[model samples]
Target: MTISPQDLLAAASHSKAWPFQEAQRLAKRLPEGKPGGVLFETGYGPSGLPHIGTFQEVLRTSLVRRAYEVLTGGVATRLVAFSDDLDGLRKVPGNVPNQAMLAEHLGKPLSRIPDPFEKYESFAAHNNAMLRDFLDRFGFDYEFVSSSDCYNSGRFDDALRAVLANFQAILDIMLPTLGEERRRTYSPIMPISPTTGAVLQVPVEVVDAAQGIIRFTDADGSVVQQSALGGMAKCQWKVDWAMRWVALGVDYEMYGKDLTDSGIQSGKIARVLGGNKPEGLIYELFLDAKGEKISKTKGNGLSIEQWLTYGSEESLGFYIFANPKSAKQLHAGVIPKAVDDYWQFRAAIPGQDVDKRLGNPVWHLLRANARHEGADAPGQGETLPVPFSLLLNLVGVLGASATREAVWSYLGNYVADADPAAHPALDALVDKALAYNRDFVAPTLAKRAPAGGEVAALRALDAALAAADPATSAEDLQTIVYEIGKQPEFGFESLRDWFKALYETLLGSEQGPRMGSFIALYGIEPTRRLIAEALARA
Candidate 1:
């Protein structure tokens, strides 16, 4: 089953995967054998803790980076995680503590504000460290850089000089977008106050392009002249974004849909600064359960840890990989379906041809993680022994207090090779299923008494199970159930209706595993007893 270089080259040429598309665009942008190979960048505004959006951006960029290497025959690449900590803190994030202290520090650079959490040197430092910590845990290869450090160390001095030279050009691009009130005071350059240490929003009084200095009125009513270079001044964000692209010589960058306008504006300013905008993507934003855009400040979406509690890291990555241009709901409710989708896509990988496999979302994600996990390559979707939905339904029948050993004992009866050592991935899934059931499934479990003819149907089903041979297959048991439901006396419009009645009266769920399969797994005698108990509960 070895794939030759010819096969990979042919498949990669024909692959229409989004990551490949992005990488193809980037490969054209990068000059062949350019020094430093290639540089890909993702920006972070350290105003709040990193959320799913941050993870999404970094992971998506990683996918494209990997694709670029493959597409260009293993060209080296570097991913820079740039944190804009020098930006002013306009408003306090609602999720953080010490609101009053945070309010006092408003309008100061984030790196200058005290950490409300008391975990790091400043608010921005805390958030930036958090971003690094989370990315490290996911085995993402990246280099973290702080904006405050970049500005203060003069790494951005040449770019600052270029921005100063094109100040009027940048203004022409930006001023039209601002309201009349803001336009009156808006200047592309914002100076850090000498006395107050806040990024001043005041109108520019003078620009000294030769000296790299900007003059502005301080918040304390003092006229100030400061070197625009060396951290004394920063451009407004739109301008800053363009300046960053030039400073870092970014080859590729991607952002959310909301920033499309910003991207256009920045592209114009980048050209004005004598630089080109990096290759870019506008991905759709994630929304909360109510379909509103998820906000990091409001804590409205699932955090990485919250989602990982119910879903595997690979499942989370797969969710991110699928149709990134489409907006998705980020909440606890999406986890099970996403995990099931991960299983479904993984199952399809083995049967697919090279082109189809290249197009599969699981291929990119699994291969990346497999390499991170020190595997030669990912398997053909044999990681899990059962569908996530099936496992969830199985846990529903097992009850909230069911022990791992009890579940394993039942699993052993169903799957011949269900040993934990042999199926470690499935063993982890069992833990996830148990937690998901405990949190979401157990409380809603409300089995009810059978209505009207359902009682007769249950009795008839019990009788059929009693009469059936002990050695009957689950499929045979399923056929018997289907036949009983098809009977005119049962009054079922369809087999689906019969199954619905069975679930509501017995399992207290709207959907469940195939009744035949459940019967086989639970054993015939136990299922008959379950029917008798449901009838008695009435």
Candidate 2:
């Protein structure tokens, strides 16, 4: 099969994600004829509230779907965001409302637990709804699946029978991987207890593969004969993973690095069961600021709500791009960089190969919906007159009380050469900067005393502003700042360090608007006044 839209091939060529490269291979291997459509599956265990890690799964899958569409010239595609709600609730989360209520439902399937928040039918449903709500809000094109429903409605009956029939083969793949104690009691099928309604993980005394039934000793010490079909039984995780791929005919998927071994075994079992195992890519897990694994239970990293509250969906999309395999810190501190980097990538797309633009994160970010033609080009949308970092700094300099209109007016004057209204994304940009300022900036905003060298440099900068010709342009003011940064006594390592000192000393933020144009906008008198204050404090 020929992958159309050469840009898709270029993207896969440059992509660091194994899933993209695997996707390219899959496209090439497709049977020549009318395509049956591509299916990508992303699974979520709704044991706790849906978190950022959950979002990453769907987001990563979406990227592959985008690549697949481009490769097939927009062929039919379906992304299944499957919820493993049938998973047992091993422990109660402390973060949810009414912890005592969840303790009552411990050891039950997550689908059976009451919604602690009293919002949905059950805990799993609540979390699943939350997941769907966010995906819908983000305009993600996906089909949601409930594992509980899939099993209850007998949709997985054939896959369940396949596992029962190949019980020893599946055991051969799993038993050696476990410890001595675990291997003694391991069973591919976990029967739902008729009395307690709990998922029973006991050892099977008899495997009637021909009859598709298994007999296991229940908690009451009774030998219960259960049919390994529908809701009565569910396969263990690895088997379940493979079974889903076969049942759904998934073409591609992505998983966490932690699951690499499980994925390998699943592939073997899938191929053995006459199922087409989906190609997958394993990405490193998200880490907190201190480099610990981001846990929904521990709440070590930014939650999806927190991220969306402070940054745009596009910014979060960019954060997941380019380095799927490498470990990266996912925290509030990285939010600003993600936002600024997105704008920078979008701004650079116009001058390069438009056909190869599918490789660019900005292309997926800005035009994933394809509401308009030529959306991949940087020139298609209103370009920001200033970098987002500057606008964020403006939030710090002007204080939080400044409204969006006020910020835009200030930007219009700051970048006098450009039209603020022409930038179509200005509204969202301003909101992001302001929200970022409130969350990560304002609480920490406080001026610090300058160093002795900084004082001397500030005095020199103050004198330059006070004595400069009134006709000095923004370019001239920028040169003055750069020249001052080069002075030896200031101990400035580079122009960047000088600017850092200036921002912290004047605006009380780590970063701010470009000082040259800022100085031009604030004028000589105000600029000198701010500098003099810093010198006195030093």
Candidate 3:
């Protein structure tokens, strides 16, 4: 166990974990008035049900917060999962019901539009509730802030005044980025129509910075003097983003790589507003299997619900935690490997050294629930007793109707630590694996007839397993199987072909777990029966 408490932070400072690296970058601009003080912010647009990308931002930010806490020896920090719910609803989300109702309310703030689901006061409320529910379910520590709440309650009053005061400067920063047509009508100040209540994009006729008001022609061609502060108006997207940083005193925030230009402009605007822009990272967006950027409007990305349905949430966390700066292919096909990688990392943590453990993904992944600061410690994380892929294969072997008790019986044979009561996490995985198999795996399975020397090779494997002790370890049993596959009589040219044949013949998949491990867990007798059944296929 590493007991050098004094050197823990110093050692972690050099560690290469992305979260630690991010924390290290953020360390320079530590907030004032308190030791280790900082505020981390993540923005959410309440336009659709929260997608994995939205969840990824929060999850990744939380990891950085954990790393910062470890690096600074318990720096006080706040994470605001801010919702930009006051933004106008430009289009109807296909996933939601009553599309016509949403279409009618286009150009209104999301918070003002009635919920198509009819569960909350507005569409934004319904979506924000889903966001909160998901965040709460994960036990993430964050304060949920609403844009409409901030604006309607005058919380953004000072920021609006700052923007009004520096209107030309912000416009100077934002105007050049627009095209010829948009630049003709664009104004930093967007007045909420007093008559229709829709957010208006009309050009401002006057900016009375001293009065916190802007005069603009409303959509009905009526001259209107609107209070730019409060809920009376909201700034355009880029201006509002910068104003938010100014208003909230955000120390660090993260955004998608697509917003690189926007971040630059927003940072400049924030500076013009007499507020320092927060330290931030621009992460790559999640892409679909087709390599297209996952778009909520295109309705192409996997929803949070779909991920949770097939894989454990922790597995999804594991997938998102790795390589934030790099775009990842988000699809159902990637689920099994992600599920396995999560457990694999967790299981490997205990065997690693202090520096290695600090860099290990599982350490950062579970540090939010860590008992103490140091890396070396017991009860640090929950590890799956078996690989999620194994469970998927287990479901295939046991059939769709297999229950927890039946699977646990086989699970007990594979790992002595397997316990339904002690490891509810693993128990949950079993259910997900079963569902994934039923929905995805079973339909793709194609058991083929064994031919030529392959038949002889299978017979030899059955004979060898039948003669060996049923209690043999996976490693030893693997060697026994390997030796049989290499016997020149089988006519096998490469080990790859042999293993592929095993996966196809036994599991009906392109690849599988270590044959020894599969065989050991499957029992020596059942594997022989499986070979017999394969051999019996004409």
Candidate 4:
């Protein structure tokens, strides 16, 4: 069945995948004579490490494709992730290896640079391969295209000719629009001299299609020769952008807000190309964390690996899904809240305003969660640590007997000291419970286990627990330990030393959270069992 604009709107409202209005407009503008389909494109310049921001753009496009498919009853939609490997290296990022190599590879294809890590054949190949692997791992079914391949294949010849034809038109328009100063130096393309940073602004002599050559005179009217790369051959960046959309049949594209003027210029070029301007163009703002834009060039980008280390895949997904198309700063800490908000929205949406625009934040979170839910690590739910330290302690106190029911029982009776209420807080608790199950249940410690002295201290604590009255509550036991600790020979200092030693022996660490609380949570039996096992190993 063909998807209608209404269907897209409904899907956007329910799924919050993209801006509802934008989706609606795109759906309405879909070619009427053709069978229903959509093409979304996101491009990446593989000049450096593929940071989380790269994933954000590509994944967002993928989400839009998925949304279209779902709305169109599984009709195929294409998502293209273009790697601009032919782009010149303007600057060497600090993290890149062999910074000096950039000088040799300055104007050459990025794929020609030797891989600094020696993992891939070239620097460009290494970054592109890693990015491709990451996208594949995340289940983004994108068609990967290398700029070098496109150029060599001559797929952009017509678009290139169009660009050259409109060179004077672009110049006239740009002069009036961007002002006279820019017009004086601007050519339709940026043809920089290898010897100097001067622009070559003379009339073209020949456009040699067979030889892929373009001969032009220099500003001083000196003859100069340059080879044209085929794909949209040798056009200015803005003109080239418009040509890309027309040549590639792009239906939707997004750009960062920083490129607003370029996007506007691209739109103008689209009119010149006689191709349909994209149905919608989204402008996304930079994502900042703690007052810093997450940028690789600025050494402020957060790596995806680091994020996965601390957060669940779902949490990461939620961050992207909840953000808006508008220009606004964002922080990483906002991710958990986005996840929480998405879950709440999913729960609330069945009866809410059916036609209302779901807030961008809510939509972003839901889409992100949906996308990540499929590829997440197995047993993730069982591995996530509980959010509250007290909850973890409580889980430990319940020990091997810990279950959802047991946890509620302890929290109701001892911890919160209140009867459980059927509210959002309870839902939060359930979420924490699931996270704990995913992250902490199957603890994998490093090879170097706790030390012998630490194990002895844990054994002493276990012996003390065994000798204590069973009828005495956990609080009473703490009181007894405190009283024993007050003795001059076994003072608070000794207790601190003992706990530190125990941590080293039991967990192979110098420190951990509260010991008495930890023992109480793991339950007396499990704590003793773990201690004994650790002591034996030590």
Candidates in order have lDDT scores of 0.83, 0.77, 0.84, 0.58
lDDT of 1 by residue, 162-260 (tens): 888888888899999989999999988889888878898888854678678788888878787779888888889999999999888888999999899
Pairs of residues clashing in candidate 3: none
Please count the clashing residue pairs in each candidate, in the order shown.
Answer: 0, 0, 0, 26
Q: In model 4, which regions exceed 4 Å deviation?
A: 1-20, 31-37, 119-121, 176-182, 190-213, 217-222, 225-233, 287-298, 326-332, 335-538
Instruction: Name the weakest run of 10 consecutive residues (lDDT summed) in model 1.
Output: 369-378
Per-residue CA lDDT of candidate 4, range 1-538, in tens? 1334665446554554354445556666662313434777888888876767777787666656555544444555677788777565666767766778766656545665678788888878888898788888776777888766776588876666666666667666566666666655566654544344233443453366445456665555566677654432345567767878888888888777777887887888888877866755555666566555555456565567755543445556656664446544454345444444445454444333433324434333334322444211232223212234445445543445767677766554334433455333543554454355345532532224445344444555678888765444556656644554445543336677765654555544454545555555445665667667766676
Candidate no. 3 TM-score: 0.93
Q: Estimate each model's TM-score.
A: 0.93, 0.87, 0.93, 0.62
Which ten residues in a row are the worst by lDDT in model 2? Answer: 369-378
Q: Sort all candidates by lDDT, best to worst.
A: 3, 1, 2, 4
Best of the two (3, 4) by lDDT = 3
Tell me, by lDDT, which candidate is best: 3
In model 3, which runs have C-alpha deviations exceeding 4 angstroms?
31-36, 98-100, 369-377, 381-383, 417-419
After superposing all C-alphas onto the true structure, candidate 2 shows an RMSD in angstroms of: 3.9
